[model samples]
Target: MSAPAKASADPAAPGERQGTRRRRHKGIAGNALWFWIFVGPFVVGLLIFSYLPIIWSLVLSFFEAYNTATPSKFVGLRNYVDMLTDHNFLSSLGTFTIFAVFIVPLTFVLALALALLVNQVKIARAFFRSVFFLPTACSYVVASLIWKLSIFNGVRFGLANTVLGWFGIENIAWLSTVDPPWYWIPLVTVRLWLQLGFYMILFIAGLQRISPTLYEAAYVDGAKPGWQVFRYITLPQLRATSVAVLILNLIAAYQAFDEFYNLVGNVNYARPPLVYLYSISLGSIQDLGHGSAGALILAVIIMIVTLLQNRIFGFGKAGD
Candidate 1:
């Protein structure tokens, strides 16, 4: 009977599968269109405003671009060659190094101390955090002016000088004195105050992430208050955060300009590399090529230092 005349096979089955496949393709295409539509503006903005300018600056560094309407002449590395021998460039580099040495360690310690205190406190937490972070909210320029004129001013009207008189320590030249003492004290002090709050916040975030169980474990292990869990448990766990703080502090120290400018006003003694670059770029007649070259060099130095930090600290590694 041939299986009672084989039932007619369903013809719509293959068509239904094909229709479902088309729907999936359409859905994927729609999602892709939406993604590009959303991200396109940001991508274009970065290309036009951020990266394009950097590219042009690098190109300008290669050619002799006049500050005026004068045409850019291709000088083929003359700028780079001259910057290598410039006395001012050398001086600025040395000064920045000295500043970094003092600023980085000091800021880290101050921030750590502030974080520990805030973490240990049980009351008025919001008030303490706000009080500490208030300075960071102010613009660097405003803060620098206050420190320069109001706090570190050498005159009798200055707050510090008034307090010094009460202690019989005499008037201290907070800005003008050369190295060993005057060079760093005021700058470091102000920088420490301004930076400690931000880093304290970072450390607070990191500390809060640590399990209370670890502290309890340390206590059970008889870890002393001063002799502390930091060296053992805390340090190991917070290694990544410590690296971040160090890298940030290092970059801040190197790029230090606002405080130097507001307080020292492009004077040689208090100038960092950035301040020197600004002066040459805007103020000098003969050194525009050299100035551009100096800036590129400074940029290179900063990049190298940042890369070194990443390498040593394993900052960008997956686990880190």
Candidate 2:
């Protein structure tokens, strides 16, 4: 049939193909430009503020530096040695350990409990959530002041003492009572109040993610409605969130400063590592090398603890 009438060359097809390639090229270029535009500032800021400071501190830690201006001498490991041998540093570590031990479990339990309770509420859920979370909006410094001046003030008229007075107990020095560390009342309470809602929100988000079908299945299997459902279904399902909350609480506890600083106001007994470092570096002494060394040491301790916690929780496992 005349070679199929000499099949007509389709000029439109080639044009369409070229147009598609050009569109794709433009799309890729636009995406790359936008990605850099969005991420460039954050990357630059992180390097300038976070990574640079960490590197500079590490370098300073190895020398006898003062005020980060310059190294007075090449002390090698002397700064680390001094920090390790210093009694005050050791005491701060012990204090932080105790605080973390108490605060971590307490915050985890209380936050989970509150989350469960709030999740169960049939009415006014948003109101209750806001009420619980409002305190977190307050600055730590302001909350510490409120706790110190209004609640746990050493005076007879303070709220805590006034309540005790109603119970026929005399006013007590809540902050100054180092004999039994009654300062922990304000310190721990403020921290709990400031932090509990945040963790509770985490748990609530986690709880919402759990499949309702799992609870139904449990119920059909004769699991009871309340704690049984939670124990068998909710708690097990919340492993990741729980681990995160616990680790965060642990780190916060170890780094505690504002509450203690404001409530105790420079007392020596209950200082955490940050406060100790501050006293040495910027406080009266101004020893930048030892401060940097202590900070690095504390950072190592926190990292170790976090890794151990992650291991215990089996984080990064396939199913987890």
Residue range with the least summed lDDT across 10 consecutive positions in model 2:
3-12
Clashes counted in candidate 1 amount to 0
TM-score of each: 0.84, 0.90
Window of ten residues with lowest summed lDDT in model 1: 3-12
> In model 2, where do residues sit more than 4 Å from their true spots?
1-26, 318-320
lDDT of residue 245 for candidate 2: 89
Q: Write the per-residue lDDT of candidate 1 for residues 1-320, one digit (tens) a residue.
A: 65423322443566656766898999999999999899988999999998886766667667776674233687888889877888887888898998998899888888888887898889999899888878787777888788888888888878999998998887887887775467477788778878889998988888888888988888888997553688787666777778889999998998999888887788876679989988976676534666778888888989999998899888877143
Q: How many residue pairs of model 2 clash at the backbone?
A: 0
lDDT agreement with native, every candidate: 0.80, 0.87
Q: Mind giving the per-residue lDDT tens digits that candidate 2 earns over 91-116? A: 99998888887888999999999999
